[model samples]
Target: MKLILKNIGLLKQAEITLYPLCVIAGENDNGKSTVGKIVFCIIKAINRYKEDLQESKEYQVNEILQEIYFKFRRALPTDDGQIPDVLRQLRAITTGPANLPEQLATVREALEQLEQSGTETRSTRQDIMDALEQIQLITDQPEDTRQSIENAFNKVFASEFDASLLLQGAKTGTIRLYDGDFLLIHLEVNAASGATLKGDVDPINIKDVTFIDSPLILNHHDLLIRSQSMLDVDRKPGRSLGRSYTTLHTKDLFDKLKEPALPNDLFATRNKALLGNIQKLIAGEISYDKSSRDFVFTKNAKSISIKNTASGIKVFGLLQILLANEVISKNTMLILDEPENHLHPKWQLHLARILVELIKEGIYVLVSSHSPYMIEALKRYADRADLKDTSRFYLAENRTIEDRNRLGEIFDVLTEPFETFRQMDAEDLRDE
Candidate 1:
């Protein structure tokens, strides 16, 4: 899927085309995380209400059921339609396979009897409630009132990150990027009392924030990422005492890249292969224990752990967790910004390989990057004779998007090497 952003955060206007193996490469403070957050937000919004991250079986079930309910509600006729729908849904839940018409007829008869007897429909209401209790679908209560369910959903869907540092969107002139999906991962800023907070400092139109589909939005306290913040202590409880930062729980992402695992069934309930491939791409690994509240990098492997890894690896791990179950679905659009940051050249190439694999498998990948290493990798892959034609690149600099067609023109202009290749005889080429 493509992601277009306008008037959001540091992005005055930016667009990134996601390839199966896309990369976002630019200088530091260029809003790479902003892009990722936009994409994450989209994912969050789509599966927002689920009691699981985008990757859980229960979350998927509820999502599917929600769609089914929406369709069912839409299909009802006019007049006594809503009442019939309620009855039919209740009936279908309690008594399997009852038609809407049949359920409506029963409900109407009960109402008529109550009206004729000049009595309240208390008994009839009890009957409806009993039927609802029997239904195998979702619970009979309103969804918003279910705190336990909402909390569970929030935990499951929240991205694994110090989301609180995400700042509020600045008011800027509107600029439209690609028409792709955008995910809102986090929103937070510091306050006047020296407290970093979640949400915008000033009220802004919530409608101003829009993604083509529902996107996931996370929140964090501003100091969550800073070393001196109390949030840090909360994040690593054992670390509150004197502890060596080097001994903190961390993992070798490179090693994980070499030996991938099938996603936990909870995460990859649908497409195991796709999840496997993604695990291979980023070298998926996570660290978690009963004592800890969240997963850390596996290499560090300590509750009071503190160690350093590149921002790229941290971001990749976060993405892997967010996207663990996404690959199995056809409708998902993966939007990323500057995935090449903090990655070594070899890892960049490895990421490229994974992106190409996903594209070939029919997944839409959208990315924004300024890294020449990443660009060269894609060009190398795209230039190969056997590569599929699904590859395309966009340049987002100088406040305007330059398509690959323009680059192709530039390549044509710069092509004196064609003559050199042609002039070199097969014997010379082979000898070299």
Candidate 2:
């Protein structure tokens, strides 16, 4: 898989080829996470394209249902507060698998009957009739997947989203993804018109993309899961419902945790083995306690709350949960942003080895980090595991570099602190 970004945020132009295990080490705010975000957005939009079209139609249908229901309510007796039969039927249609066209016909006939009954004013009847027009408009043509993906990309980026953040006074920008020769996503941004998408989506190529921004997400599982459920049921057409920051990644992981594990086939067996490795690393297994609706670490025949568990333990713990649940599959691409965040340098190295080994199991891994230990450890394990060629590295500073030999360059940039310390030591020795 390859990704090309032109004039995206601080990254003026970057053509990143995603290998089995890809790492990009960079300073903060260089849009290192941008590649992962774009990958996530494209995968989601393609996979959910049908659902988006259907859901948009459903939303449009619900608006008419709601309008008709309110019209009946205003005409009904207020003292009893009883819902009219028409309102009941409308509510039922929305609550179940609706035959939307048939339902629309029924609603239109009902409206006509109400008009003849002399209960509604002509203007009110006209209002009801006007809303019904949207039914035809919505059902007439398909909702464009390009628009859906563009909207999703915007939401995924949130506060950091700016399609036209060009550099060198460039007027246009683009983000494109390709699987070999097939184009999966193509997003073009005109400096004036914001953003537009034009490309073919290779829907079946990528099964899924999971971004683990932080293991700390486990702490906010309850809130994220609840919100995700709401979004699934009735998400409004705009971004006004969500916060300034993107919640898709966090909410997605939390929501997936509650889903049933995949079938226990050969694929699942491989996942189980990886899960075992993670459990061994932490010297414990992380399991979800259904009764308490929480995650717990079990070791020495005792289970303890993740809150009480060390943060470093939670890093591997997150991987343990994902692998156990079969969320990280062969076709799945796992994106980790600074996973070395709370881990010790020793664990960081160990985690790197685990990640490299994970790629060997047929999963794609993209890691963005500032840890030299983690990057070096990954390179070592990737070599020992005979996956050195499939392991790619990048240095994201002013421009993103795409080359494996540049791994040392990435380490040098990350290890500048050691150089600074060495210089400080020399200065102290001279003073002595």
Candidate 3:
């Protein structure tokens, strides 16, 4: 998949053609993280929509209309206490053109009855009249009304609604994903207001994408310790408290784990090998104890809780469990933000190798990193004959796709700290 972005955070414009292994490298605050988050948000939104559709098992149109109606009914004035009847009439009237005339007749009869009773105030009569006129307008332009309703519902359910809150200072942006000559999906957002302006394409059965931000660590803990009762807590009051990208990613991971695991045969050979390599680096096997509701690490005839493990181990441990449970597969788009966060230099190299192996297994990895060692290891491993064409690298500072030669330039810049140290040593010797 190829992702194109415009006016997103510090990236004025960036078009990245994602291969199985893709890297976005730059100094801090140069939009590398922003790109990762945007991709994550888009993929997360599409996945959420798919999950909702699958669970409801209803026609998309009907599902959207029902939600809109719920909101529309709630917003109606309660002066008449007849909104429920009004909604019923509206639904009945919009069923077909044949019903329009009959519905209009009913409305006329009701107006007559109201006039005859003379018990209601003029305000009540005016409200009914206005509602009737609106209904007539909607009935007269049925196609337009349906299109308008779909657009309204799409806006309400768009991923940007929550992404805007998670990605602070986001203003306006456009995301376009394409496969070869075909444009798969195009989504536009006004991030400040959490509104999606153009998203007409139905994203059902599209690519499976997962985003990993900093909160993966916290989410890992939640997965180990969270219970059904904890998730059942009333989150209405906390809705306004705002969630970090990590929090949302963690919640999604938690939900995915609730599903039954796929068969072992469904696991690809390369994925298993890659995961095995990571396990070797961690020096232990990470497994969730279903009966105990805890993540246990067993190594050298000793068992320890995952919470007592090191941060780097915890990070890799999360990946281990996700893959073992088959929540991640070859079809998954794995976006990682700073995967090197808590790792030593050697472990960073290990992670780079694991990532390359994931790409070898047909998983698409889009990673944002500031670590030189990780990027260098990735370039080295990706250059292998079988993996050469499966990888692409970019320097986010220039906001352009880069080849190995350009990556060398980035390497030079990243290594300037060594030159500074050398210069300081020379000055100290001269003063001596």
Candidate 4:
């Protein structure tokens, strides 16, 4: 699956081959999430695709097309040579705009009027001309304008996911790969005017290509979304906090792990697998308390959940939930941003191992990390596989004005994987 992006968000251009269990590692504020958004857009395009994108919203198309039109109009509008620009402009103006359903309805009505009038009228151009004249925009006349808008509506803005929709502190998201393979989990939220806007998404497109299923849009983005402030909530189980901010007790996990569990329990079947993995990861015997709901570990005696628990643990739990619930499946691409949060060096290494397993199982994962520990973990994993120049690793840094084309760093952690890991980790420590 090859995916192409033009002037979409922060990415000017990117061409990446999709691999199962691919990881995207970059610094903050380098358009990590934007890549996800483009993927989501592509999935939506596939969903609403038709012989003519007449069913597509106008304003959405306009956002992209309008930019080009204004640019070309400034450069050379009269140039019939600018038909591509005109087509691009048409593509932009045809997609429905945000908070402008009335405009879409108006455009739909005008098209209907033109179609109805064409039966009685000798020329279809006359009806089109009449419609555009009423559209409050200057154009080359009815037929040209109507056809232009219609043409714009038909072109698809192919994409798979938006990272910002899934990860926090991610803005100016970008598209990474050109792979058209994606899954669209659309979440819509009610608007102030009793309308709805896309809210959340789940995409499985990464650097190494893997196609899972036919693209489908799940209209539940509304329920899964939340603001960054919600992350500040205490993880303790309580009615006063957001669902994503909370943690599960060991006893609760154990009970849920039991077979024939409630359908509503998110981690029921996966909990047992998750527990075994955790124990194996630390090379320890683990026990849980039914009273305090804490986990006790032997060999690493200090690993009592009370003082040893961290955000990394919670993040692992969340990932486990996602896997257990089949949110991410076999032969799917997973784009993960900042997976090293609150994890110790040991756990980071363990995560690297887990990621390697996922890759071997044919699941693609893309991850961006600020932790040198994570970078080192990846180094070790690459070493174990005897991978020369780990081409999967990427880093983002301040690009010189002269090197604008090089917005991020794509490095093959050859013999210097460990050294590269140390340098990056040191840089992060200095920033902190």
Best by lDDT: 2
Instruction: Please give, for residues 1-432, the per-residue lDDT of candidate 1 as tens digits.
Output: 345555443454565554444444444455545665555433433344343322233333333333434433343333544455353553453234424345445444544544554544565445544443443343332344233233332332232223222234443222122333343222222222211112212211111111111111111111222222232243334555642221001111121221233233325445455556655554544432224333444432232221243454554454454445243235445554556655777877766665555556555566656556666776686566245455655433433333343444434423546666777876598898
Relative to the unseen true structure, what is the C-alpha lDDT of residue 426 in candidate 2, on a scale of 0 to 100? Answer: 100
Show model 3 residue runs off by greater than 4 Å.
Answer: 53-171, 191-193, 197-199, 202-206, 214-246, 256-272, 398-405
Runs with alpha carbons beyond 4 Å of true place in candidate 4: 1-4, 40-275, 279-309, 382-391, 397-432
lDDT of 4 by residue, 1-432 (tens): 433332334444444333333344455565544444344334433333332333222333344334433333333333355443333433445453433344335444434543453432434444344444444342222333333222321222211221223223322223322224552222221111111113323333332222211111011112222211121231111334444321111112233222222232333453456545854554443333334444333444444542344455544543443455444456555555566665777788887877765655545566656666777676668568654233254444321011121213443322357787899999999999
Per-residue lDDT of candidate 2, residues 1-432 (tens digit): 788888776677788888888888888877687777666766765676567567767877876777776776675443377655666676676656758876776676667657666776878777777777767777887667667766655444442343434544778888777778788778787767655778655554668878888887667656654464323433564534663333566667776665553222212445766676777788877767777777777788788877888889988877776777778878788999898889999999889888877787788999988888788888888999999788888888876545344777877888889999999999999999
Worst 10 residues of 2 by lDDT: 260-269
Evaluate all candidate structures by whole-model CA lDDT and list the values in order.
0.41, 0.72, 0.60, 0.40
| TM-scores for all predictions | 0.39, 0.81, 0.65, 0.40
Q: What TM-score does prediction 4 earn?
A: 0.40
Which 10 consecutive residues of model 4 have the lowest summed lDDT?
A: 212-221
lDDT of 3 by residue, 302-352 (tens): 768767777788678767767776667776778888888878888888778
The candidate that achieves the highest TM-score relative to the unseen native structure: 2
263 in model 4: Cα distance from truth in Å? 6.9
Would you list the rank order by lDDT, best first?
A: 2, 3, 1, 4
